[model samples]
Target: MIEPASYSATEVLRDGRTIEIRALRPQDQQALISALDRSSPQSIFRRFLGARHHFTEQEISYFVNVDFVHHVALVAVADENGKPVVIGGGRYIVIPRTAKAELAFAVVDQYQRQGIGAALMRHLVILAHNAGLEELVADVLASNTAMLKLFENTGLSMSTTRESEIVHVALGLSLPA
Candidate 1:
């Protein structure tokens, strides 16, 4: 069953809007799928490094299916026009035998700048820290300046390596005592 108490937050946006950030539930598969379906091709490419019309059964299963230990996933939702919708999502899978995790995030095209992605990242980072993770890494498209700027705003160790069209970002989360 989905445990909201373990990982959930309702925060106010900069513009007085409200959003709920919580652990993704199994029932959220279709909502997420639809969110992806509504994402622009460029946004999809920035998130996945390629274009995908939709998530396959296996892929969607992997998304909403999380152990909350090694694999943590969360979604940002808000009421739009009296109906709740998934605006953004973030997740991190711990690297085998390491204090690091691979992270990813995707926001709906319409909700790009309403702090959804930033909020998701904050929540995901807290989850990762609680789960004993030390770092988060992702390969972002070089052309995706918005995502890169978001990563920079996190104030983490923010190091990157560029290879062709992709930029690998490694943000160290474990701070020294």
Candidate 2:
């Protein structure tokens, strides 16, 4: 049985619109898959960095099964007639060897630049810090200017490079004391 997560509600304003951000729950899988499937091929490629389309069942199951101890995932959503629609999501994987983790996120095309991505990133940063992670890293395509800007706006120290037309980025997190 998939259980719903209890997340404190929060909102962000972008382009004169409001979006709600919160933690991911198992119940969100269907909505997430639907949004990802509907995403444009270019957007999907930028997010996943490959021409290989479609998320495998095993990947979906793993994303939906994360716990606070090992992983943290959050989603941004909008409610229409009481039905939740996923607009964006963020996740971090904690590396046991060193208190660091890799982060990833995506906002639906319609929701891009609407503060959904920024909110999700902020949420994940806090989650990672609280979970004892000292740094968060992301591997983004060099052409992904929007994502690059989002990371820059977070005020974290970052390094980037262009390798074969792909930009790789890394950000160090400063956990609040």
Indicate which candidate wins on TM-score.
1
The lDDT leader among the candidates is 1
Error in Å for residue 30 of model 2: 0.6
lDDT by residue (48-125, candidate 2, tens digit) is 787747778999999887785678778888875787788778888887798888888877787777788888887777
True-structure lDDT of candidate 1: 0.86
Instruction: In candidate 1, list every pair of residues with a backbone clash.
Output: none
Candidate 1 stretches greater than 4 Å from native: 1-5
Counted clashes in each candidate structure: 0, 1
lDDT of each: 0.86, 0.77
Residue 106 C-alpha lDDT in model 1: 95
Report model 2's TM-score to 2 decimal places: 0.88
Stretches of candidate 2 off by over 4 Å are: 1-5, 175-177
Model 2 root mean square deviation, Cα atoms: 3.5
In candidate 2, the residue pairs with backbone N, CA or C atoms under 3 Å apart (3 or more residues apart, or in different chains) clash, namely: 142-167
